[model samples]
Target: MAARTQATRLPATDLVRMGAIEKLTTRQDFETWSFLVTSMLGQFDLEDLIDSTIPRPAEDHPHHDRWSRLSKKVRCWLTLQIDSSIVRELRDESSTGWSIAYADETYEVIRRIIVGHAHTKAKSTWKSAIFMKREDYGSVEQYVTAFRQHVKAANLLKTPISPFCASLLLLEQLEKELPGWTGSIEAGFRSDIAETMTENEFHEICCAAIDEGNNDNADRSKPTSDKPRSSDPNGNTSSNLSSSSNGQTHIQKHRMAPPKGKSARQYVAEWRAHEPQRTPEGNYNYNIVR
Candidate 1:
């Protein structure tokens, strides 16, 4: 029994307190998490899995089983420390044809990720984004998501302000975007657990507002239909299509203007509304003066 116990026991150096690390929520959180996580891997004698000092063997190789096990252990330690949204972003990078080869990447893949983010720079840009709203992005959803990202980037910053101050800042930003929002919303945004940005609570709170904004946008874009029908100079009824060489109108497969109610004014409004370069601020942006 004593011999079996001795055989099963790991060396003192091989054991590490897993609780020593925290989840990596932002670039600010990366440095500390990376150092501690690397130390933990080293303590377990698995540093080689992430360091690129050793090459991996093919699956059929004799030593492949050991390498695969160690690589998985290292990968688990790395990923389990990241925020789930961040995890999804990392996994989604593969679709963008980035450096990572697969969504479920090995520790060496994690190592590459770390190498990309471990650069030493700090900026206050995220501070400005804390107040970010609809000035930039086209949709309410895009604007909302950008605001969430800015807050997330600010998450792990060492306090120039207290956590109490941080919550107040978040509240102020929320109030700017949503004038009447208060009570439980203020409470949730103020709470660290509720608006972590990785969590769905904040998003769920604003879903109604988002849908309403989009629906309002849709309604405004719809053309008015009560006008009397007017034929083109060529006597063609299809206003959305082009005049054929023989003075007949041909239906254009690619033209998107309304068949029934489109007028010159409506077409211009739609054009400016959909223009990517034009910065729109809701329905007010549709009107153009000569």
Candidate 2:
């Protein structure tokens, strides 16, 4: 047999750099270019690289062509990463003589703009992801897993889901598939207390309920008795005897009544006689003080 060889993979930074170069050369749309460039720069830590490569000079020089050339190259790269409109604006704004200082400021401004835009887009995506409803036929686990993927993609790892919100969503999903199970789970979870639970805790609660429901269903589907039973002396079979006993117990429970107590009228009269009278000033007068 021939030995198999694994293909070599490129480093993440190299891949990002390649992508950035491709976008710079081919993508004409500003938004696409901006997004790709910003993502690549972040992945490769290009800002830090540029900063370290061009340190500030202690004294200002009348002729600093070397620093000016490096700054120009950096600016050119940034311009290529954006739209033509932005390029025109940058050229118009580049009235100041080029220097290392000017380059640093320009890079910082561009970085901030891209980072801000990225954050806004991310926030929107996260909001939409979390608010997504469960699909008609999708399982709770599948829906939750998809929501988690969305959270991860939106870079919301640190964002904590409110327990109240988590529980509400879980209950909504559960109610659809396991009607009365929600009530059983809710009986254990006091609204105020459950509201304090995290999303993970609520998810565990949902899983437990699902397992319990499955077990209950399995138990109900099981055969009650496989063996034949002997008839009683009265001609009742064992099954009939068991059913009668159950019916008698149920009857006794329904037939039971409340213990004898004072009559409602007498009780009300007694209560009235002992009740404190309210004065004109809204104070209770136990002794009926004038």
Candidate 3:
């Protein structure tokens, strides 16, 4: 019989856009990411590095060197796809959070973020990733960096996204927010870039919303006395701990004043025709930072 021929092996760089996939930011995006990653690994026959079937060998074994090299490459590929915010938190858990011996370390930091008291802070980090944007940081590079720090801290703690925070839901908000924007003016962001607004412009949007809310309150002529005060016979009135003097909700106040541009009323109006995102339906203790 003639000698059997073997096919040549493929390197990672040959996968073309294998690295072009979006960074895994939220658990919402995770399902999609997982699908893509698994597909990519399988295509190149590299799934053994992470999949359950291939048990890791010890250092003394002959296959250990080759396994370690490929495993490390897989780990690099995995980490590179994660946001920086999540990476930082994972670093604390282990430099090789994605252990060459196994894959649990890889997801360990996606499990961190935010450092809000260690675990709580981990969540804060993830929130930052979900709400980060390209425009807010003045540059795409800066924005990506900030996004990663937040992602690193809040691993395994994906939360539901508010409708307002979804970039697609709020796309064209910036362009429509022109003092005289019409017929797609020169200064407005293109629709292609709007999808990223949720990650970046959400802070500014919240400020505009807050201003609008306050404006509505002003029109109603509602007294700032949103809560009752305790008075002593000595003629001193004590403020309630439940609310702020300016009536900030029991949750921490994160008021970010609108930037120098269109009126807050304008931004709010173009978005939802003057109806803003209302919240706090129950005992879910979540605080979104401005």
Q: Which stretches of candidate 1 lie over 4 Å from their true place?
A: 1-122, 156-198, 225-290
**C-alpha RMSD in Å of predicted model 2 compared with the true structure:** 20.7
The lDDT of model 2 is 0.49
Worst 10 residues of 3 by lDDT: 2-11
lDDT per residue (tens digit) for residues 1-290 in model 3 = 42211111323443334454688776557657766877877776665555543445555665555555665667777778877866665676576443433343453344333222354555566566666654676433344345444443343344435323343322333333322322233245556544444534554543443454345446569655555543433445544345668877564433434345857676555654633443233222222223
Clashing pairs in 1: none
The 0-to-1 C-alpha lDDT of every candidate, in the order given, reads 0.51, 0.49, 0.49
Residue-wise C-alpha lDDT for candidate 1, range 175-265, written one tens digit per residue: 5555555344556543455234433454454465466557767878999876343333244433335787899987655323443467878
User: Candidate 2 regions off by >4 Å?
Assistant: 1-117, 120-129, 147-160, 209-290
RMSD of candidate 1 to true structure, Å: 20.2
lDDT tens readout by residue for model 2, 1-290: 42211101112322233243433222124345545654655454444324433454333442244445444555556656655654554455455442324445665544333333355666776686567776642455666556545544444323445555656665676676666777777777766674466656765775775575566557779988765533322444433223354455221121212224756576557657785555455644331101
For model 1 the local lDDT of residue 34 reads: 66
**Best prediction by lDDT:** 1
